[model samples]
Target: MSSLREKLKTLEELQQIDLDSNEVRAELETLPAKRAEIDQRVAEARRAYDEEKSRVEGNERERRQLESLLAMERDKVKKWEGRLGEIRTPREYAALSREIDIAKKTNDGQSEQIKALVASAGELQKTLEGKADALAEREEANEAELKGLEERQAAAQQRLAELDARRAEAVKRVDPGLLSKYENIKRRRAGVAVAQVIGMTCDGCHRHIPPQLAITLQRANSIETCPNCHRIIYAAEAVNPPAPPPA
Candidate 1:
């Protein structure tokens, strides 16, 4: 059992703790930071995908142009070959042969270009496909995690509301001076200000109380402070633990 003053003190501290433990605020505080991080990652992944797509598109366009040029060169070479079989004079034959050679050279250049373009398109398409697949997977993972976090946030908010209601009821019964003292101590002691005294032990610090002091503590109506931890002490059986159950 705690003294009236000590009980009120503990109640006030518990209330303060509940006030500070606003789950909604905590969740809100982290939301922007989380969103910023996720947004950056998503943007980066998307940019990479877009760049890959553009590369593939550009390669395809170049490949198509190269193919068209190759076809035109092949047709010119065929026409030149036919013209060569009908030539009679040396000058005419020489001029016709030169024209045919030019056509052959053009066809060779166009064919090489087409082969290079085709290879580039193949590589670009493969790389683009891989990036797109990775982006899709990453987006799905983010969405799933976001959903889970949101659920956790909602549950935490509901739990906090319940705690706040209890805290409000508890605070109404506490004395102002006791409440003030509890808050002051709690600020320095990680939310703990008053602890139960169990026999000769200070529960706050787990240190044994001097024999004389422990006797005085059990008899005193005034709030007693633990010498070791400076916490207000109360003689509560729960804190002092009774002897173990009989064997």
Candidate 2:
């Protein structure tokens, strides 16, 4: 039969497995939030791009409307000039001439405005193109990062499964009462039931143990709980002594 020291060592191994499982579980719980953060960034980038596109489209619609209005004004000026020679009186001719002049000025102003808009359209198109490229780049980068996160999550899940299986098997090696005591302490001590005794200190809580208890723990004849933290403490010297120096 294995000594008590061997049993306690096995329990510590199980504790290590459980601790690893805890870390993986923590990562699994937060993986979705990490993914959500990436999704949010993508959504924001898309929204910004859409807003810029809408503004450009609005400018185009306005330009078209102005062009249509200018066409009508030019047609009016042409019709009035054609009637200038057919006027019945000087006053009528003067009125028609004034109307034609006003319409020509309006047409000239509309043409100038349209030319400016067309020039600026090139710049706006360039801006739009730049934004699109940036959005696409962001999407690619975000997708790659998201993929990496997914792979990590999958690996952690697989590791947790393996650790859990190890824990289940390891539990079988301990005495039933000891296992029950360990479970009880694990629940109350934040998932750490066993702590190693290094020197005179409890590794779990970093508190000093009594000199007598520390000496007793080193003997490996029995298992004891830390007086201050109440975690099961064992001496590593009993199970994992230092290697002898080569002659």
183: Cα error in model 2, Å: 2.2
Return the clash pairs for model 1, or none. Answer: 198-240
- Quantify all predictions' global Cα lDDT against the true fold: 0.74, 0.88
TM-score (C-alpha, index-matched) for candidate 2: 0.90
Q: What would the C-alpha RMSD of candidate 2 be, to one decimal place?
A: 2.1
Screening candidate 2 with a backbone cut-off below 3 angstroms (N, C-alpha, C), the clashing residue pairs are: none
Candidate 1 on 93-172: residue-level lDDT in tens?
Answer: 89988988887887788788878878888888889999999889879877877787778778777777777777777766
Poorest stretch of ten by lDDT in candidate 2: 1-10
lDDT of predicted model 2: 0.88
Top candidate, metric lDDT: 2
